[model samples]
Target: MGSAVLVLAIGVWLVQDGVRTELPPRPSSAQSFPAAAAPADDGRQRATKPSIPGMGASPPIRIRIRAILVDAPVIPLTLDAEGHLEPPPPDDNNLVGWYEGGVAPGQNGTAVMAGHVDNKRGLSVFYGLGSLRPGAEVEIERKDRTTAVFSIDAVEEYPKDRYPSDKVYGETSRPELRLITCGGRFSKETGYQSNVVAYAHLTRAKSA
Candidate 1:
């Protein structure tokens, strides 16, 4: 299907809904690049590619969510015409995009990733993520053969307009990660009416 068709299949009514997603008014030059949705080749796990500033190198990260032992593919944060981050595809319900500007998975501060709870089909990679309870473990594996494990601290659902801006995108000193996707009631007019955000914290790290 075309991009527009695929978008409507989810809840993205407009391709570039938000016009200008200004980065925090700070002294950084990190530009947001649009990440491509994971190919719907199969349920097989694909390696994640990180984006580098100069070389434009593709970096890969390995992630493990202990509660579900999920090994998802991560992509760099990029924006569409509206300047909003581009989302991953609902490939077998798997595919996620990480906001690179926030923080590295194993490093300090919040590391955010966005996924589709479900597609026009029915379920997405994180369809059941809301079921994750506190204390659950979420791991992020880096190419350097190291794994960072995070524990689920909270799972919340928020309205789009009232999304927790500070809490969700705010800076922090501890290494934290947020898994976001569309949730709540659905309508033919709108695929998903709300968003589900799962918050997690780094609890362990080991050489992989």
Candidate 2:
């Protein structure tokens, strides 16, 4: 998808459909990159073990993040007729949307996943995404009966208009993951003012 289309789709689909009385936790400044600094590549080389090889294409079936107690099924997300990527069904708070058009979770490229921060009933799947810290593990179970393990590198919140599409969706020589959700200020008119994105890189993979 075009970067412009992705920006619009994420801004629109990630927001809560109805007013939520309580907002999800926002990523603190300590978790974000310094204003003048760009996202670093050091994390990918920080692994102590020998680098693990990326796997072939295999759709993700589930995602588990022990740090925040996230254990949700992942559904393939496709673009609508209007060419906007679709979000997961609003009624299913535990479901996550995996951009099927992008690289799979275990593949040697950036894989994008998004979840709702909140819904009308209450906090949803990614409500605590901003709380994740470096070194936390995110495990994605794939259709091939393998689990791809990723380590958190950073969590940052950006205004919708200023989101760095290139950093989040850019290609990578190694497997990487991005978990996103609506965050920052909210309004009945605009939904949300910003988005919380968690950056991670694959560390290991194992058979399920």
Candidate 3:
């Protein structure tokens, strides 16, 4: 097995509370955020604010991935053992294998959602994630009924240990999204050896 994770130091958000995380080192420095600027001489320190991801002046409502619309649910976020994130389950796959965070979809940064490719059975949600083409679209629906659409810009796979940390999870200058699922082979000795990452970028967003 490759001891090298692409950039794993990986951080994934779980809730509005911003479930804290440590992401792997990034493959690209362009995605890296600078450390908080030094505080001024005043007693007050510099308040480093994280930019809202995906929900800026213009928010996305629908995304298209693998030619499917990720329609927004009346309530996109859910919790019950499975974790929370932007794109929740597809109303199937009965298992503790989902994201539990709020789902307005953070802006500017990468609003992430995750699922399991398989449990003990075999072939679960996101099992086809590797099949997503670069141009596939992912749609996210909103409260107003409008849809925000994005296109798959790239897809990269990484070994568990070598997953790039900074690039995948770091803050971005542009709004982006990440869909994650387990990939590669598993080992009784270890675990899943790789992670499948689908990278998508906004193309069209509407506020129906």
Candidate 4:
């Protein structure tokens, strides 16, 4: 996904009572947001191991982030008629949505995934997303019976109005993954004040 074609509009679901007991953590002060002109070093040590080669396109079936105890099913998400990306059904709080229009996870491009931070009931699938730190692992299981393992590089939150679409949705030479959800402040009228994004690149790939 490129900046021009990126049309995601996430974190719109309202939480119960218009408030949440716990908000996801922000990126450590040492990390810096990627630059719009070019990707910047997030101040984290790059993995010593070389990145795995990209794979053929396959729909992701599941996503796991052991550091945050996330293990959820992955569903395909599409752009609505209005060009905005549609979120997963609110009825299933544990589900994650993948942008089907983009390259699938493990492919030679940035893959995007999203989930609700919380629903009317409470915390949802990506409630702990912002808490993840550099070096953490994110595993995506694909229909082809393989798992793409990624290592986190940075996590940051941006106000909705100022979202860096080019940085977050930019094309990449190697396989990369992005996980997103609502973050920052909340209110009855505005839902979430910002969106949290975790950037990572494929470190390993294995058979199921």
Candidate 5:
């Protein structure tokens, strides 16, 4: 197989949250959001405002995991024609993308975040994702400046052919997060053979 086929296969392998499909074209400029603005002095930024999932749904702006020393911005991603959730732009190795159609990080369902393990150059945003263990904390900063704290439940890997999509993207009683990246042996013909998933649930929410 050619390099393009390898890259595309790896991209699809990294995303198992939505309907399986091929990768989409590069997102248009309109898909990108502006830089988050600083909070005003009046303390308005301290408020936790809810959006779509009603009570506590705010779009995540950044993600932090102190144990792994990961501090990365979050981008919203949409599915392509075949319903596959797009990965973060390959050129920006430090960013992660959240599946916009799914439950937000602070809402009452699983919120999926996917990132590349590495590109042709080197390590990517989620290169350390699988190293995270149970009890470690994953903090997601929302546009409202409130941080939704999640406690890692487990780190699991599954073969690409047997991906547990229903469990990974299934409904939950409380807010939860799933961090996904490529793992296992890599082959020029088939890409990574497994996916590394980090499972966590909300433990607390506070003003940033």
Candidate 6:
């Protein structure tokens, strides 16, 4: 299906309907790129183990990206009356929103999570997401107390008008995850013009 068709199927409309007037001012270059310590490993050790059977459907409670030192709580999100996936409340910049009705992280399908790149106050939880490289780790702690580990496969940006919904929300045989945030040039009149999406697949899972 095309981007438009997939938009409705996968709840991409909410992203397009952002309230431009509510956006905060952009951060300076220095504020946007804080230096982070390197991770001990490249987030690939989990790739060596096999995923637990039938363990991919648990609700995710938190997400951590060690490379950028991001550890944030996750809240469940649902579609609104307009058929759009609800975004995290604008007041909570540190929280990420997971599509509760969709595939859970580590499930055998694409799981979706989104966060604010920044808020009116300053940088948000995913402010550094654009800096993540391939092989970086994205660990999702689920309600089951088990952790689903994923290895970054790619990071991409697309104009909001040309979002590749099929690729972002497409079905997959292996457990996969998609992290999204607003990106690209910010416009005072239009807000952010692009969306950043990080693609990754479940490499392994560890019990609490």
**Top lDDT model:** 2
For candidate 3, report its TM-score.
0.56
Which runs in model 2 stand beyond 4 Å of their true positions?
34-51
Q: Between prediction 1 and prediction 6, which has the larger lDDT? A: 6
Residues 88-160, candidate 5, lDDT per residue (tens digit)? 7777768888877777888887788888777655667777777776678898999988888887766776677
- What residue runs in model 6 are displaced by over 4 Å at the alpha carbon? 1-54
Q: What is the lDDT of every predicted structure here?
A: 0.52, 0.84, 0.45, 0.77, 0.66, 0.68
| Predicted model with the maximum TM-score | 2
Error of 2 at 96 (Å): 0.3
Our tally of clashes for model 3 stands at 55
Candidate 3 worst ten-residue window by lDDT: 11-20
For model 6, the run of ten residues with the poorest summed lDDT = 32-41
- Per-model RMSD to reference: 14.2, 2.4, 11.4, 3.2, 13.8, 7.6
Estimate candidate 3's alpha-carbon lDDT, on a 0 to 1 scale.
0.45
- What is the Cα-based TM-score of model 1? 0.68
Q: Against the hidden reference, what TM-scores do the models get?
A: 0.68, 0.91, 0.56, 0.87, 0.75, 0.77
Give candidate 5 regions above 4 Å deviation: 1-55
Stretches off by above 4 angstroms in model 4 are 2-8, 11-19, 31-50
- Residue-by-residue lDDT tens digits, candidate 2, 16-58: 6644777778888888755654442445343332235678999
**Tens digits of per-residue lDDT for model 1, 101-161:** 4556767655667665555554555656666776677766666676777766557665655
- Which residue pairs does candidate 6 place in steric collision? none
**Greater-lDDT candidate between 1 and 2:** 2
Candidate 3 segments exceeding 4 Å error: 1-106, 120-122
Stretches of candidate 1 off by over 4 Å are: 1-60, 90-92
Write the residue-wise lDDT of candidate 3 on 147-185 in tens digits. Answer: 656666556667766676555665555456677665555
Q: After superposition, how far is residue 41 of candidate 2 from its true place, in Å?
A: 5.3
